[model samples]
Target chain A: SQKIEQNSEALNIQEGKTATLTCNYTNYSPAYLQWYRQDPGRGPVFLLLIRENEKEKRKERLKVTFDTTLKQSLFHITASQPADSATYLCAPGAHGNNRLAFGKGNQVVVIP
Target chain B: EPEVTQTPSHQVTQMGQEVILRCVPISNHLYFYWYRQILGQKVEFLVSFYNNEISEKSEIFDDQFSVERPDGSNFTLKIRSTKLEDSAMYFCASSEAVDYGYTFGSGTRLTVV
Candidate 1:
C-alpha cells in the first residue's frame, strides 16, 4: 500500500527560528512533491512544488527539498513568525492522471 | 484571479437520500477535480474531470457516485444515495497545468444524518 507519513505531534518553535517538517513515503516513486499550508476551517493553500529531479525549491521564506532515493521531502520555513503557525501538508503526485497522495500534515506553532 | 466556488457552504442530508454538490471552476482551467476530507484526516481524491468527461476516479467513487459538467460554469457531483460515511467536506478544485497545480474552493461540508 502507498502511504505518506508526517509527524503527528505538533511542533513548537520560537519565533525567528527555522521550522522543519518531514514527509516520507513508501513503495512508490513520485514524479513530484508539493507542500501546502492550511489554516483551521480553510482550504489548503498552494505553497511550493519540487520535482524528483530537482534538489530543492524556494519561495520567499519557504523552502522544500526532495530526495527521491530516500523517499523523503523536507519543508522549512525560515525566520518563522507567529502568523506562520499552520498545518503543513505534503502531497506527492500519483502516476497516470493528476491524482495525488497526501500526508496527514504536521501542525506547527511559532511562539512569539 | 478567479477562484473555484462551491455552492451551499454547508449541507445536511438524510441518509439514503440523494444529494448533489455543485461547483464553478476557474474559467481558464482545463482540468477539474473533487476531493474529500473526513474530519481530522488527509484530503483524499475522489475523481478528476477533463475534456468534458471523467479522466480518472478513485475506488471511493463507486457506482453510486457520478460527476457532470452540466454547463460551461457548473460542475456537479451526484450521490445516488447518501450514506453516513459520505459525510465530509467536499472540495472542488481546478488545475491548468499538467504538473497538477490546483486552486481549491473553501469546500462544502456535507453532513449525512
Candidate 2:
C-alpha cells in the first residue's frame, strides 16, 4: 500500500526566517504531488503542485521541490510571516490516476 | 474568481435519518468530488462525478450513499441513513479538468446524534 508521511507535528519559526516541511512516501512513485493549506474550521485550499518530471516549482514566497529519486518533496516558505501559519498537507496522485492519498499534514506556526 | 460552495455550514440530525449535502461546482468545471475529514484525521475521498454520472467512488461510499446533479448548477450527496459514525466535515470540490488542483468549499459539518 502507498503511504504518505509528513512531519505530523507542529513547526514553529520566527517571522522572516525560512520554514521547511518534509513529505515522504513509500511503495509507489506518483505522477504528481500537491500541497494544500488548511485553516482551523475551514476547508483546504490548493497551494502548489509539483510534477514528477519537474525538479522544482515556485509561487512567490512558496517553493516546492520534488526528488523522485528520494521519494520525497520539500516545501519551503521564505521570509515567512504569521499569516503563513496553518496546516500543510501533502497529497500524491497515483502514477496515472486521479485518486489522491494524503498525508496526516503538518501544522506550521510563524511567530510574529 | 470562482469557488465551490456547500450548504448547511453545520447540520445536526438524529441517527437513522436521511441527510442531503449540497454543492455548486465551478461553472465550467467537468469533474466534481466529495471528501470527508473526521475530527483530527486526514481528508478522505468519497466519490467523484463527471458528465452527470459517477466516475469513481471509494470503499467508504457504500450503497447507503448516492449523488445527483439534479440541475445544471447543483450537485448533491444523499446519505440514506445517517449513523453516529457519519459525523464529520463534508467537503465538495471541483476541478476545471482532471489532474488539476481542485478548489474545495468551506465544508458542512454533519453531526449525527
TM-scores for candidates 1 onward, in order? 0.97, 0.97
Model 2 / residue A96 / CA error / Å: 4.4
Candidate 2 RMSD computed on C-alpha atoms after optimal superposition onto the true structure: 0.9
Q: Which 10 residues in a row give candidate 2 chain A its minimum summed lDDT?
A: A93-102
Q: What is the C-alpha lDDT profile of model 1 across B1-113, one tens digit per residue?
A: 78899987999999999999999999999999999999999889999999998988999999999999999999999999999999999999888875766888999999999
Off by over 4 Å in 2: none
lDDT of 2: 0.92
- Give the per-residue lDDT of model 2 (tens digit) for A1-108: 778999977999999999999999999778899999999889899999889899999999999999999999999999999999999999988653656667889999
Off by over 4 Å in 1: none
Candidate 1 chain A: worst-modelled 10 consecutive residues by lDDT: A93-102
lDDT of 1 by residue, A1-112 (tens): 9889999999999999999999999977888888888888777888988987899999999999999989999999999999999999999885564777678999999999
Model 2: residue A8 alpha-carbon error in angstroms: 1.4
| Clash-forming residue pairs, model 2 | none
Go through the candidates in order and give each one's DockQ.
0.66, 0.68
